[model samples]
Target: MDATSFILPLAEITIAGAIINASVHFVPVGGAPAAMATSTGVGTGTTQLAAGAGFTGLLAAATMASQAGVSLANPVHMLLIMLSGAVGAMIMLGLTMLIGQIIYVYGIGIVPAADKCEKDPITGDIQKPYITPGTTGHGIPTVCFVSGSIGAALGGLGGALAYIALQQLGFAAAIAGVLAVGFFFMNAVLASYNIGGTIEGFHDPKFKKMPNGVIASFVSSLIAGAVLIGMAMGL
Candidate 1:
């Protein structure tokens, strides 16, 4: 009702939107230096597209919620607004998927003729559009293209859940609980990735990062669930 009440969540979502943009869509361009020491000679990885989807969804949902004057500061308010935001994100995600699918089905792939790569020197984390040696020169594949869309859809769901939940349990506690479970889940995912990658004979490993997704999902879902509980309690 009051401007302050209305503005806070909108502000939060806006901040979240910026975070999403950074995480999604802002990949390092494809090029050389993205070489892998694999048997495939030169190649590139499409992990950024995949990993950045949730962030993208987060932004998309936040943008929709904020623009539409949706707020989630409490259980009833959150419940009322969730469907709208989620639907918007889902639609956006679906469109991305459609575009990606079209590209994959029609074209062979997208190649970056030149060489350019970005990374975090300290962490060895990549920060650019992925350009693997195999895919780098030859270019990115259709499969890779469509998969990016898949990431967006999943991300939308995750973001919707996270923000909705955050409204109920309080942010700090929600994130903390999610982190505790996330650490363990991350280790498990890492172990699985290593075992799977090894058996598959691919360096496509990621036990460390997958847990982040798990945790984010856990936090968001938990928040959403809590809000639902509160609504029931109020009733």
Candidate 2:
């Protein structure tokens, strides 16, 4: 293989890592608080939510790419694969938020509210009044749902791109899938650490630290890509 082959795939891997890191910042995570209707977002950690959605997307993209006559070299096919990933991720996260919303509203008897902002940026709904005393917020608000959806899409895209880069580097399907999952987790964890704790999606103050995570993921990904390339050469 030529220098271009190595360089291009390496670049894709690096960008995908950065994008995955950025995507995590957009997801709303309320941790233990949301589980008890004390805070906003889904009752989960960032890495788990992101990994679940990202893996779904990765599976969808891989399935699409593996179809007969599908060529990764073809731009149209590539776009379709990426779209498949994004849609898969969106569906998974969307349903999760929806179901969580149902439980929060009907089961837990708490209103969906965002404490990070007085007004939702997407729906322009007032947020402050719905919140309970001594609690951050309750349930996944409209803004958080929207933000999570966007994050899922980006996560899917990043996972798909990383898988594509691995395939381009000549790894088999099984190898590529395993490597992609590891790659996804690495970046996701980096972003999660940057967050430091629960966050209320993009509207939260924690989102401001996204750039730091992205930069870290980029550097880490570059190193990982180099190692993968070396492995490919050996193969």
Candidate 3:
């Protein structure tokens, strides 16, 4: 009912949105082409991949936060909750990339390559020579894997922040979770649209468009946060 109550969560939601959007840009999404070994990264959209990992992290954080003696009001406890989310998300994305890499390398028999750069930014391996003549690239390279994991971590942290803000507004765990999921998807989709199609990771030229996505998410989340505050007032 007070301005402080409304403003705090609103600010948190806005910042979380921006973080989620930026995180999506760090992920390497190769889309349908990647499924067939014609491009780099996991064979999915940025939104899907980010959301998947984010939700998993959210679940982990919620589990930790809900435990007896855990106090969200304590900064250390809050940090631990957020860190749990980040670690959970990283593990989810790591396993996902690992499995995809296995299939890409062993099942499809394609060498890991990135078309965006002449050489692997991390491994320093020649990229172009390994890529198939007709394809942009193939398989999950080391840089892409690292970038995706970083993105997943950010996504988890963002999701946890949103949930914590909602919980602070006095919403029940279930309601706060649903709201957080919706909030995460809204920002994730915005980032995906900004990507326009595909991205290879942080090193990809498409990463430069991240600001556009972050701005869009920030504005959208502000509106969503207002609606949430109105709902909280009723509750």
Model 3 bad stretches (over 4 Å) = none
lDDT of each: 0.36, 0.95, 0.91
Q: Which portions of model 1 show Cα errors greater than 4 Å? A: 1-51, 68-137, 172-235
Q: Whose lDDT is higher: candidate 1's or candidate 2's?
A: 2
Q: What is residue 2's positional error in candidate 1, in angstroms? A: 25
lDDT (Cα) of model 1: 0.36
TM-score of 2: 0.98
Cα RMSD for candidate 2?
Answer: 0.9
Error of 3 at 188 (Å): 0.4
Worst 10 residues of 3 by lDDT: 1-10
What residue pairs clash in candidate 2, if any at all?
none
All-Cα superposition RMSD per candidate: 13.3, 0.9, 1.0
Task: Summarize candidate 1's per-residue lDDT along 177-230 as a digit string, tens digits.
Answer: 343233223322332332232111111222234445444534543453444344
TM-scores for the candidates: 0.35, 0.98, 0.98
Error of 3 at 91 (Å): 0.8
Residues 1-235, candidate 3: write the lDDT tens digits: 6878678888988899999999999898999999999999899988899999999989988998899998878889888888988999999999999999999999989999999999889989999999999999999999999999999999999999998889988899998999899999999999999999999999999999999999999999999888889899994
Give the C-alpha miss distance for residue 2 in model 3, angstroms. 2.3
Compose the digit string of candidate 2's lDDT tens values, residues 101-140. 9999999888899999999998999999999999999999
- Return model 3's CA RMSD, one decimal: 1.0
Which residue pairs overlap in candidate 3's backbone?
none
